[model samples]
Target chain A: MPVTNRQIRLARRPVGPVRQEDWTLTEEPVTGPADGWFLGRTRYLSLDPAMRGWLDDRPSYLPPVGLGEVMRAGSILEVVESAHPDFRVGEFVSGSFGVQEYALSDGRGTRRIDPAAAPLPTHLGALGTPGMTAYFGLLEVGALNEGETVAVSGAAGAVGSLVGQIAKLKGCRVIGIAGGPAKCAWLTEELGFDAAVDYQTEDVRKALRTHAPDGIDVYFDNVGGTVLDAALTRLAVHARVVICGAISQYNNEHTVQGPANYLSLLVRRARMQGFVVFDYVTRYPEAAREIAGWIADGRLSTREHLVKGGVDAFPETFQMLFRGANTGKLILDLT
Target chain B: MPVTNRQIRLARRPVGPVRQEDWTLTEEPVTGPADGWFLGRTRYLSLDPAMRGWLDDRPSYLPPVGLGEVMRAGSILEVVESAHPDFRVGEFVSGSFGVQEYALSDGRGTRRIDPAAAPLPTHLGALGTPGMTAYFGLLEVGALNEGETVAVSGAAGAVGSLVGQIAKLKGCRVIGIAGGPAKCAWLTEELGFDAAVDYQTEDVRKALRTHAPDGIDVYFDNVGGTVLDAALTRLAVHARVVICGAISQYNNEHTVQGPANYLSLLVRRARMQGFVVFDYVTRYPEAAREIAGWIADGRLSTREHLVKGGVDAFPETFQMLFRGANTGKLILDLT
Candidate 1:
């Protein structure tokens, strides 16, 4: 019997803000696994700002999603049919299976995720690529030490939420920068950030002054541009600014926004570094274990803003992340 | 008997370059030493660009050279008379003895500069502030590992010249950046620099690309702005950029030209830090010993661009440094 499922394919490349016309929904006939392949039914599709970067035809750490190809995405799936010895029927797995209802994988770079360990969506979030990005970026790259102050932009979002939490777990005084009162409340009140800066209402520089009076030691930057400029002014001696994402600049039609006032690095004797999560693929299990422990100990909490939708709703759901419409990790559940 | 002689005093504050109009030479009625004081006759005075910074009414690492103050300069003197317990008459002494014919000291912070062991100006150049700045800036801050590529701008100047020779002494592949071809040639041919880029004629970034094809491991920055930006582009993985000074930015009438492209730090996971040599004052003797030893042996050489003029010529002497007219250590010998 032929296996078939609905898939979201890239219809056209986007210019600025990605629209529904950019994506095309279609049904694809999935071939049965030949030998070491397993059939995957897409359960939860992760909506990340990095998806916008994949739409543009540029040389990034990852290749752009080609036109007429299935739009790339990280998904958690239940194995329905298995010809692979590693993956069995009824086992849950996670992989870059694209925005689809069903997928067939050769099991290379795919992990069998546990549902009982945490919610299936949490595996796509706190235990997923976002968690690893935060872990390695903060500990390895930022070299965050105990008693240091950590100030993270996009503090209410997926990766940044975890970054602030993990920094706090490392005994750092964590400050969160987000859009609205709700996100700030979620960060400081729920996620355990020491301080929260509402980028809309409060001046970031003034907020940083009020919170980190001694200046920030580690800055986990997610939303770049103006927010980055504000953060640069408040860096202490030997501070580290980690460039995780620039969601604000991703949609700009003119130019990719780079920081203007980086001379502060020279004056403050500090450093700024950028990283991609894929660089730490070999160390993911070690990172995931620590994040899981934080969650279990009530030190780190996983917040998933689940948006129920079919594969056709991928374009609109992904827009929610850009508009700051979704809090925590935005996940699309295809039932 | 009165220890009376001529002295130069700061007449007015300079707006841009320290001109001849900024100084006034007059006869000062000097007095003999009291109970704990020693009277010394000035022999050789060290003229430095740091004098220019002192003339400005700003809080730098040290206090500004004040109006009506005997224009501050480091001097080597012969003790004509002594009442201080530790210092004896006819002994050689070194201290911040202003631009004057005679100075009285309490021997609190004065050290004996050996004229028999080496030339008196060597105490100001290779064994002075420039030498100390270069030694600590490269080893402790630049973290100069063996066999690493080191790129230093202003390589013919006091600090830069010493940095290249020391990096070479430490088994590093050193590149010197200077203003003229003659200076550049001297750097590679005599000073033992691996390569030299004349910034006046050569494209700094392109030259760096050709010379340091393996990419620069450590950048000892003295001239900031464009040279720093050029070095920033050529950084290898885990590079360290040491910001010693920005001679280009110091005299800027308008906005100090900063580096436009600094995002490369993110790609390479590099670090750039600025430091003042004064902070490392306690370690000065330690650096002095190592650098003095390097000069004592054939491992290092000293160069002095000496101007034969009275104390009244101090302001014009300082202006030459900003114009890049002098090579090696710029000093004025007071007769």
Candidate 2:
């Protein structure tokens, strides 16, 4: 129980953009497990934009990461030693293991992840929280119907890409909205979305009009400022808007711009609902089975944008999500 | 055949409040019918707050009554002569008939109403558009489940009363929001609502918190603006808010007070859906049958605030609704 561990801790709460000074790298000897505890070694870390929200001292789905604590993160780890009979030493597990090289777990809310069925990173992406998010957000909250039209903003990202593809799999005509030509190309040509509207150059409202001539039935909103406004104007009757994450407004120096044309909901008889994926923890297995089936049948695809550097690289790896630096699922390999 | 006919026409558009000057009384002679036309006499003229929306030059569920034309009104009339095969003499027909003593109909969209089941005013209120609206708004749009709590604004009015009673019949705990103590008393004492909040004197938010301690599951919003904001704060998880009417904001000289606490939908993962009851015209009969069954079993109570007046009293009868003058269904008996 004298294993040395290195960790990235929150030096200060970030203002605007996260800086290097916002983090403190420190080392400590990993402590031994108590009666109910199990020891684990970090194998991979899940870099998510929601981590940014967790840093701010405001009300959110989860509490903010305290200063001088190991930065909160979802991680893949191998149980190296165990006093808890349920967790074996060779088993792969996932939980809020934080940005650390090694950790001791009491197995409060840990789940075993199978490395043989899919890659370890898939547990963080297509088979994990982000994947379950896209699944529940689109299908349940969005009330997505087969053959309906779906439009997704930030379409090339981890959740958005899967959202578009899931809509397509549901027999919906899917339109992807992303920043650049590469992302748009990947959304439509590679991911099999019905259309991709490059929001960088094109007028999103006009593009929506062209792609969904009838109107958008489901809008999976990731980038929320003006893009959310644009989608508000094009909602069809009984449309369901999934307010997943507002990435565009996250870095705002001012207050977030809510939609000016919300009256459209009154006219269209539509609905907008927000969802945090963790709320569906009990239903995750149900969604995972459906998603895994799609992945296995060649109806779905999984992509991981991996960045290697272990726990020390947490700061820069976390920044990449906000800058749109990584595509598909952004995972940090501890190896 | 020729007969003297009297009609109320839209003479001018109202600036703030509608007056007698806005309408013109005219007497005309009903001539012989064409091949498809039949003689009809106006038995009951519907005096509704929505008449105000119909007077304005804007698009709504129904088009505006054009200047110099007969003011549009839903009427229960008796077919005195038959030209169309589906039509027969002495049969009461409900249609978008103008405010007139007598007229000829081509019978495009008319429904036969039996006076034996209930009176003509009951047909216009409890078994007509208002009843149909309450049924579909609660059952279809609200997706109201049994044991869920339903809070309705303008709870003493036609649609709101029906909404509360229907929710009760569906095993929902119903709370009514009305303007006065009398209406609130009637809602609770007679209409079978669990509680009624008098918004005229009491703090609505505090009242909602007291009555619905667990939070509101369905908000059938007949009165928008401040009432809606109050209800928004009390929404439970997955709550469905039905945007029926905004009578409180209908006559406002300025813009309606759009809810600022709408982000509660995001916070609770609830939904707000707006629908005009006209959208469910196809299922009006289905709504009528269920509502009638509830009435027959004494599970639902029907109340009409009938203003005894002829066609000359149309403007005043209409004005009463905006002032919240009448409880239950406000109708004009043009007998």
Candidate 3:
């Protein structure tokens, strides 16, 4: 175990987009695990769009990260010392271990992860929160069916990429909307998405018409803005819109521009629903096992944009999430 | 049969709140029904919030009313002359007969109504489109469960009133939000709604906090806008918000301000779904039977704001719906 621990703490709440000055890195002497507790060092830190919402002091699925506290994040941790009966030394586990070198846990919400199953960072990426989010948000909340057209915004990002892949696995036509040509090409070429619309280049509304000629049956929305509004107008009867995340609106200091075409829900007799992956805790093992099978069978692709640095890299890396700077899962390697 | 048929036709689409000048009254010579068609005289017309949406030249569940075309409406009609096999003289039927003294139907989308079962206006009110909207909207779209809390906006209006009543009958605690003290009182005292919030007089958010301490499980929203936003904030985990109508935004020539607190769907893992009652046509008889049973058992009450006038009064009476000047179902009786 390290003699000292480095931690990133929230210094202030962000306005509009997050900045480096909002976080503070500090060092403290490491302490041994107490009774019913385990000490683990964070290996891979997971950065997500939802992290922005957690920075604001508001009521969400999870509580906001308080100022002067270790910035909250999901990470892969290796148990260094253990006083808890269920956790032991050298075991890899994942949980909300925060953006720090070491985490002290009573094993309340941590789940053991196997390095042999996939890479350590893969657990923070495809096999971790992003993977689980894609799994449940598409299958459970979206209720996707075979041969249906599934369109997703932020198509090259962590949740959106995996959502398209899984929808394809379920025998559905997948269309992705991304910011640039390179990301759009990556989605259609490498990830096997049926088609990709580069929002930065093409008119999304017109592209959606050309691609999804039969209208979208299920839309996995990760970025909410005008893209969502365009998709709204093209919904088939009984379309199920999974409100996974709205990265576009997360950084907005102003009010969220809710889809002006929301009445399309009435016109098309459709549903738009939101969910938190944590709500499916009991079913996680089942989903994780299936997703693992897909990965092992080479049906699912896992990618991580790894940033090599200590705790200080968190703020800059987190900014990449909202700016659409990083594709696939963005991670910070603390080791 | 009348020698001449008086009708109201759309003059031009209104930019905002409909004006009297937007409609033109005309008279046409009454003709005998052609082969396979029946002639009918209108009795009561069902004035609905959806009428405003139909007036606008936009794509919706149904097509918009075209300029110079007889204004489309649902009404109770007495078969004055019959050339169709199934039609008999004086039989009452309901269909899209438009705002005219006489209609010609081929029995395609028409359903016969028995005046002996309830008053003729009741069929246009508690047993017609409004009642059906409340039934499927609450029971199916909202997926309301016994003992859950249901909050509805436009509490004194046709659909909202019936939604609260049906929710209460299904063993749920019901809270209503409406304009004016009398309308709120009608919901709580007359309709058996557990609580009522007068949106015009009280702080709706604060009232919702006090009434639905556990949070609203099913919110049947008819009048959207700020009230919908307030309800969005007070949702419980897995709450269902049925988006039946947004009368508040129907007249806006500008953009619709969607719920600012819609992210609460993500926070509480809730759902917001919109539906058209026409989509539930296969099960209308099933719903109508149950709702009529409630009325027979004295568990339901019926109210109609009756307006007596010729076709020229159509424009002014239609305005009553948007102005909230009429309680319950607003019907123009042409008898």
Candidate 4:
């Protein structure tokens, strides 16, 4: 008897906001794994803003997902069968498993996970790429100092949330910029951020003037566009602007809106730097250990917005990230 | 006998390109030097792109040149009368002496220069602020390394020309982006630039691809507009962009056009940093000594476009920078 597999594949590249017509759901018969390979059942899929960049055919850090191929994604999966030496049946692992019910892996980037250590979704949120992004983006790239003021955009998102918390732990005053009142409140009250600015309602430049009167020492930017321009206007002398991501401009049909106040770098003698997390892959274990300790000590928290309905729900659930509907990590529960 | 001082004073702030109407020529009786002051005759005035930034009533590294005030300028002057202990009569000095035939100085920012070492205008050109800007901007801020590829915009101008020469002296492959055939020819033929892109006729991005091949290790941006955008796209891994000046956008009546392809910084893991030459004033002697030695040994060369007529010609001569009319170190020979 053969098993059936359901998968969402890229149909066409999206122009602005991704639509359902951009993807095609297909059913195929699952094949057994070959030697040095393993078969896994997808349990959860991580939907990130960076996924949007991969959909464009333009040159980037990684290649674009080809049409008719399974949409690339990070996921937590359970090993159902294996012919490989390391992976065993009934063991859970994390890797780029794509948007499918079942996947075959050669164990290239796969890592075994202890499900009892933390929630399965936690492996995708805090202890995953988002966590690593925050750790390196703030501490290493930002070079955050004690008592210095830090401002982070997309403060309620997975990476930004962790960034603010980590800044707090390092004795820095952290200010967060988010889209709504609820998210702003969560950042200030729940995450221990010093202050939160509601970018949806308030003037960001004025808010920054009020919150960080001395100007931002380190600006960890996830959202770009107008908010980025505003932050540029309030940089302190020798400030560091960490360009981790620019989710705000990811879906623009035209070109990205360049920061108009970029000349502020001259007046302020500041630096704007960009980095990719995968470049620091060799040190992931050390970063992950530190993050896990913080999580265990109750010094850090993780939030996951789980949407159920398998791989077919992927297109709709992925839109939530751009719409700011999800407060934290947006994930699809395929279990 | 009293000296009649003819001065060019700021009459109004400029909206776009500066006009004769923006300045007022006035003659005043110059009094004897005070107890700690010295009286000096202006010899040559440096016409810089940064002067345009001073005319705007906005926040910057320095205050705006106030209306009715003598226009600030870096000039080579000869002391005629002195009451100060440090400065002596007939000594040539370099300082911010304003656009005037005679200037009264307390010697706060003034430094004595030996006219026998090089030409008088060389002190206001290659051994002055422009020289210091190139030295620090490339070596320290850009962090340029040997055998690297370097691209510099406004490559025929004072700072840009020196920037390319310094990069060449460091054993780097230097490419210069300048306007017109004459400036481009001079950059490669006389200045030893490996390649010269005539931005007026050539496609800068394609030219960069042909010249650099791999990518530019350092992009020293002096003209920030379409040229800056082109350079941003060709950055190598860990590239440094030194924002020294923006001559192209300095005269715009509206907002500056930001670099549309700034996201390349992220894709290439690059950085853009801005700095002021005044910040490195304490180390100017060290940099000047190195530059002077390079000039003495024929490793580095400098060109000065000296315009005749006294202080009254400042308004028209300054316009040459915006028009890209001068090749290197535009100066008003007010001798």
CAPRI-style grade of the A/B interface in model 4 = high
* lDDT tens digits, residue span A158-178, model 3: 889999999999999999999
Per-residue lDDT of A24 in model 2:
96
Which one wins on lDDT?
Answer: 4
What lDDT does each candidate get? 0.85, 0.85, 0.91, 0.93
What is candidate 2's TM-score against the reference?
A: 0.83
Candidate 2, residues A1-335: lDDT per residue as tens digits? Answer: 67789999999987877888999999999887778899999998998877777788764557789999999999998999899979988899999999999988999888899887688899889999889999999998898999999999989999999999998888899999998899999998999999999888999999999999999999998887778888978889888888888877666655555555455676788877776778889998898888888888988899999998868888888888888888899999987
TM-score of 3: 0.97
Place model 1 in a CAPRI quality band: acceptable
Quick one: ranking by TM-score, best first? 4, 3, 1, 2
* Candidate 4 C-alpha lDDT tens digits along A83-133: 999999999999998999999998999878888768999999888999999
B1-335 in candidate 3: lDDT tens per residue?
44999999999999889999999999999999999999999999888888999988777888899999999999999999999999999999998999999999999899899888789999987889999999999999999899999999998999999999999899999999999999988888889999999999899999999999999999999988999999998999999999999999999999887777777888899988999999889898998899889888999999999999887899999999888999999999999
lDDT of 1 by residue, A198-291 (tens): 9999999898999999999999888888898899889898888887878887887766555655656655767777666787798898998888
TM-score of chain A of 4: 0.98
Q: Given candidate 3, what's the lDDT at residue B60?
A: 83
Best by TM-score: 4
Arranged by DockQ, best first: 4, 3, 1, 2
Report the Cα interface RMSD of each model, rounded to 1 decimal.
3.4, 3.0, 1.0, 0.8
Q: Taking the tens digit of each residue's C-alpha lDDT, what string does model 2 give over B232-278? A: 88989889988777777666655555665565676678888877777
Model 2, docking class: acceptable
Chain B TM-score for the candidates in order: 0.94, 0.96, 0.99, 0.99
